[model samples]
Target: MNRFDRFLAIDWSGAMGERQRGIQIAYLDIEAGTGPVLMRLPDAKNWGRVVIKNLLMKLARADRRTLVGLDFCFSVPWPEEGPLPEGEAPLDRVEELWDLVENICSGEAHYYAGPAIRSMESAFAPYILCDRYRGDEFRFDRFRETESQLSPKPASIYHCMGAKQIGPGSFAGMRMFHALRAVNDHRIAIWPFDPIEDANVVLCEMYPSLFYQMAGLKRAYDHETIQNTLAYFHSGSPPRMSIQDEADAVISVAALRALAADPTLFSDPRRVAAAQREGWIFGLAPS
Candidate 1:
């Protein structure tokens, strides 16, 4: 197997921000024989798809493996088209999605969601814990949470949680849970989610001084600060590791994993068809 040269991470969100209210895209480039580099596009609603496609194009153009990862629900409840008949109300398609979730949690599939992480009081609660299975074995644990209510979701490529509640308990809570599960199970591999190495893969190339400036700053290393930094960039705000920087780190890790798995998924016609059959969302395409 060849080492992926191009890796892209995404910190996705549905809400709009102060400057731009749309998806956030962060890119990291790891050359076969070189170090890591970072690239980014300001905010836009469809930024997610755009960045991925552009990155792939660059990789393809250079004949490099284009790896990409995102922290979003590629599989969602099918949208309800129109209103129902007289007395009938709308139904939640979550149950259908849940069937998929069950398979993931049971380890029948490759990935699933993480349990919600709230306060310590909430984290230890039973209902909050999710079911996990490895082969015939199973374990349960509470969800993980971030400071901000709005943040990117975590992913699980290997092990995932079977949720008792619908819609990823919370954005950060369940997604981070799933990502951790994937890492622990070896379904996915990633650099440590710390600042020094993984967080600034291209720090030496871009914003070198910022990296050193943030060193030893407690807020610089805070979980909330990370997510906030991602949001800032998405909103077209100036760089501030206090919030958005950390979020990008999380997104970068996830993106690296996605790209490593199938850099050609977006380009290979056969892989696209197979992915479609597997129920992956394919709306993201380069313009």
Candidate 2:
């Protein structure tokens, strides 16, 4: 039976691998195999290509049924194709990169290429629900439920791809990226970020007490966001002294989700961690 053997959770950004601290931080998750990689790219130009290239290559090499999830807008309405009026020709790189991702994740290419991670906006029709952060839970009956704040005008076909009114760093923005990818790719599965409603039960499987303690630290062993703490643990490194300790914990949460999905396919925690020292450790197998 064909089943998933490995997976990758990516928090991608245009500025990935170009942070002042170091660009390699994104791969920290993939390399460490501890949590969700913080993919802070430098900009939009080659970002899409760079991400896809690495992802595709990794999936190819693993020779396993791998699922890669990313929180980013992957689709946009095809604008009127015409000649640029002035000096905007060089920017064609953006569209080109977008096409690459769309093609790889959609139609016939996706079935053979690999699995995709998309957001709620896409047409994948995956069910999702959200806790609404209000403490009062709400279920999303539709494939996608947009925020009530959008205004008098209804959402357009392109609404999913536009910059969310809330701006970056907010979960709202993440949804736009996911929706775009969903519409573009047939194989990708789109979902929401709500804890209670989403089918991605992995987010809820972490050791909470340990997870929170690690997540709420002053300094991180590695320079990761507060949401990435747990992912670092898979690297065999204990929490470091940094303000971003919570980041490590968050990362760890992602790793555990991957681990819980199919524990038998993973290695002993001790052995898997040891392999991390040699190079990137995506996952382990049962001993």
Best by lDDT: 1
Question: Candidate 2, overall lDDT?
Answer: 0.31
TM match of model 1 to true structure:
0.31
- TM-score of candidate 2 to 2 decimals: 0.30
How accurate locally is residue 81 in candidate 2, as Cα lDDT from 0 to 100? 38
Candidate 2 lDDT over 29-113, as tens digits, reads 3333453444444663323434453444444444344444433332222223311222233223323433443443444221221
Tell me the TM-score of each prediction against the true structure. 0.31, 0.30
Q: Which 10-residue window in model 2 sums to the lowest lDDT? A: 141-150
Q: Residue 209 in candidate 1 has what lDDT?
A: 15
lDDT of each: 0.31, 0.31
Error of 2 at 152 (Å): 24
